[model samples]
Target: MPLPAMPIETDLLLAHLNGQRQHVLGILDGLDEDALRRPVLPSGWSCLGLVRHLTEDVERFWFRCVMGGEPTAIVALSQGTEAWQVDPDVPAAVVLDRYRQEIDRANAVLAGTPLDAPPAWWPPDQLGDWRLASAREVILHVITETACHAGHLDAVRELIDGRTWLVITT
Candidate 1:
């Protein structure tokens, strides 16, 4: 299915968001399963765990639950599962696939909805007084969050194998 057309600003935002998402994935490329699952920093978050967090918390929570008011997403958010923990039995491929799936779903929400549209649902109890009035605001917030995490992933990847996202060449 094709995504619906979006305004230019929305398109730009989505483009930036997608870039960061790819940056995150690119940082983890070529890592073995053990390296992906192994925590390299004091924060105790592995590359795979960060991908899971982006899938469940950032992509699913903001796009599905907040923008689309998806019932399953609402239930999942209400349960308050920690998104940063990947079960030992879960394969690395599964974690990566889920992130891709969530990105597709999130894009669907962004495509069909107008930037000015208010969120379909908001969890007052979950967020307390905080609020985002429109889809544009939500997109901006997600872009910032995803980009920040991509930077973190870059650092983690560096720690793992001295790989960096970018290298300045003269």
Candidate 2:
């Protein structure tokens, strides 16, 4: 079958991404400290860790590093993978707030950019210049990344409480 005409790709992308975003948040809803902190993987990442990591990395990598042409990528923790490690002392609620704020900042960056244009360029914290990507590609990448993580959280939530965010209706 031929693809349906899409007048604006960005709007379609944002809609689908936001839908997945909601599910990620939904899985975290009503969870107490134990549920949020319980490790679902042998690697020891909890639900809270996934949320916190996404909160910081989304904006820094996509907006600042790629779109704004900044070299040094700012993250929740400068220590790379440790960014996904959660500190149990902090409330899961706080991490969600930070995620929302970063998303607002990211949205502003998207609003001001022309999707097809060459992304801004700077130099080095980790990324090579060869990895430069366009605004459109970055948006799609963010959506894909968010959706992928949401799937992880879905499994984590189910393992923690035997509950799921998905439903099937015929």
Candidate 3:
């Protein structure tokens, strides 16, 4: 069956955000289980662990918990789970799949929301005076954070096997 065309009136901020998300995933491509789970840097964060962090802290935290006011995400946040520490028993595929699923849910929240809309919930206790007043701010924040982590992944992937996300020839 033929696929439907994407809607013409797409959100510009969302486009950038999704691009960064894809960039993160792209940097993780072609890595084996050991490579994905190996901590190349001194910080001790694996690629899969970074993906898990993005899934929980960035996507689910911003869109589901703060913007959409999802109770499960709220409770999860309250418990302060360490999103960047993946257990040995957890497969790399599981972490990647969870990130993809969280992206889908985050997109759902973004679809019904206006850029100017205030977040439905905020962690006043945890954040203290810090705040993101609108959906636009949140999206921009996520995009920035995702892009930063994508660069981190690019460096890590290169250290793993000399892979680069992009190359320029002059």
lDDT of 1 by residue, 1-170 (tens): 66667789988989999999999889888999999999766767788988988998889999998999884774244244367778999999899999999999999888889999999988768777899999999999999999999999888888888999999999
Clashing pairs in 3: none
How would you encode candidate 2's per-residue C-alpha lDDT over 56-159 as one tens digit per residue?
A: 67656677667866636565443556778777678778888877777776666666677785778544555544564678887777888888999998888787
Question: For residues 8-74, could you state the per-residue lDDT of candidate 3 as single tens digits?
Answer: 3336787888899999989889999999999877768789988888998889999998999874784
Q: Relative to the true structure, how large is the alpha-carbon lDDT of every model?
A: 0.87, 0.74, 0.85
- Superposed Cα deviation of residue 121, candidate 2 (Å): 3.5
Report how far residue 112 has shifted in candidate 1, in Å. Answer: 0.5
Error of 1 at 74 (Å): 4.5
Which of 2 and 3 is the better model by TM-score?
A: 3
Worst 10 residues of 1 by lDDT: 74-83
Which TM-score value belongs to model 1?
Answer: 0.93
Using TM-score as the measure, name the better of candidate 1 and candidate 3.
Answer: 1
lDDT of 2: 0.74
